[model samples]
Target: MTEWWLWMYVAAMAGGVVLFTRWRADPCGVPLSEYRVAIAIPLWSGFWYLVMALGGGRAEVAGHTLYWARYADWVVTSPLLLVALTLTATHSLPGRRWGLMSTLVGANVVVILGGLAAELTADATARYTLYAIGVLALLAVYGLIWGPLRAHAHRQPKEIAAVYREAALLLSVLWVGYPLFWLIGPAGAGLISSATTSLLFVLLSILTKVGWSIVDLGRLRSLSGRGRLTVV
Candidate 1:
């Protein structure tokens, strides 16, 4: 399918980013905690992008159409993305916050997987129910960010706290696109073609995965190289 070819290019770009991040990580001279998680996100993402390109699935219902091997990709990559975000944002969170973060990450998974389920189904009632549940789970994720997570980030060393705050903002804004595109893109209302969906997806990945990694690398460098970074 032509869609497959288009995604192949996207996957190549993702793969290139993975390599570039890795190369950039070591030079930063700090044990950037973000890299381990960041690398896995794109590594898995690129794999699924390639898989979807070559062997993707399709569904159409109520005028909504989807090339949905991308959902399967999200099933794995989405969780990893949050994992990186939580760990980066909570760089200095206490032991208890770890448990809270885990619960939030679990909720995030349900949200993405539930969305995937919504896409795969053709029943209007069932689809909307799944979407509603997914939305609720995603809200729980936002709730945690503003709740316990925010408290911890605020308590961290001021400069480090600033980095965490910026990372949290990026996570919040970039991830909101998932549901937005889902509603308007090929998979939900057919307002956009699958190519347009893939392009948007590509740009989002660049902004989130690649962009976040660069931010993390810079923060780590600040912490480890210049000695200006602080943690408490």
Candidate 2:
């Protein structure tokens, strides 16, 4: 990984943390969509920590970066997959959130294990290729399945719609960027393009989540006003 980009990625990661803090502090003003999508923070947080701890400080990695990078797939995927699945299980979801969630989780697991095997077996191409495909598939399914629930949530108000839309677009950004950085950016682009991509992901995570929190807050306020929130 190029040294310059590595610092850039670090800066971006820092920005994300800042945004998450803002969102958490002002949840009432943020959108509900945030509560779910914000899961990305934890994923990235774990990843960044892994890279630093195992890959020799922020600026350098003494050995094969792949060794540390490989752990990222499992570390980021496992917990996030669980969160996505849990959110989908809600009765409030219009369709089978679990089914779609399962698909996404299953795909990640497959890619993680496949990548591990490929790496262990000395098949770099196979490992990265599987990871790329799995991520793309996961993104597509996430958009399709979660899109509707978000839409319904948006239908309640213009502000709500704005929140959901922002969240969707943010998700899209991640879907697009993560793969590009991995597939096209130089090896350990995690280090090379660290600042740019990390910043992008973090900012998107925060802004979209802000929108999400706002929508949810608005909805709750409205329900309370109508005495509907307590009906159930």
Candidate 3:
């Protein structure tokens, strides 16, 4: 558990950096049609970092640390459901894409909150892990949806679709990879494996976020090339 927390922190930090850097670049700038979605990305990413800094889901001597941190972590990611729903509402995403994103986000949100409730009330390990696996599986599904979305967006120029797709893809892929570490690792890999895996997860997450930022920056540059516009 200690090792797991460490790795989780690393992953969270990486994801946060990627998000913050992109925010710094102001790719979407202060306002736009998708301002909520744009702002929410970094906000959620920062919460992820807060979760790690707070030491999520670990058994401290007082247990309060993990208790509070875990809830914070859940809350941090919960906006994903809202974002997914809003995106689908736009009707810009295809049927399959919308359905998959909605299902993944909806299901994960339910399971996560339920698991947290169960943890607080009953302290069930199996339930938590099972729900976690489900979350991981959903993330993988997200990756599949994102790939097609990315392709679809790239087909059109000067649309926010491509940038959104890139961000979504990066986030989904990193999460998918993080869960795979737990499912595929050896039975008794112990601290070393857990810590190493956790670190790698963080690194990948960070890289993915950063990658999204780069794409957004490129898009901004392209947008700027059209004309010099100052913020109002």
lDDT of 3 by residue, 76-180 (tens): 454453343234223233333555456556655654564444334323366456546556556555654555445554444435454456556555555555335
State the lDDT of candidate 1 residue by residue for 1-232, as single tens digits: 5565557556655775666576555645434455666666667667666766665555565456565666766776667666665665566655435677678879988997888888777787888789889999989988888777777777767777777777778778888888887877765776888678777876776677667666765675667566765432
Q: What's the C-alpha lDDT at position 111 in model 3?
A: 44
The superposed Cα distance between candidate 3 and the true structure at residue 212, in angstroms, equals 2.8
Write down the worst ten-residue block by lDDT for model 3. 182-191
Give candidate 2 regions above 4 Å deviation.
Answer: 1-26, 29-64, 67-70, 73-99, 111-121, 124-136, 139-158, 185-232
Q: Report the C-alpha lDDT of model 2 over 1-232, residue by residue, as the tens digit.
A: 4334344444554555455556556544333443445536444643554465444433223223343443453346443633433342232334435565566566556545544443343345665666666566556556653665464544444543443454445444444554554444333223555445444534443333333334333454454455433211
> Model 1: clashing residue pairs?
none
Task: In angstroms, give how far residue 212 of model 2 lies from its true place.
Answer: 11
lDDT score at residue 9, model 1, on the 0-100 scale: 53
- Please list the C-alpha lDDT of all candidates, in the order they appear: 0.70, 0.45, 0.47
- Give candidate 3's TM-score: 0.50
Global local distance difference test of model 1: 0.70
Residue 74 in model 3: shift from native, Å? Answer: 5.6
Clashing pairs in 3: 11-202, 14-206
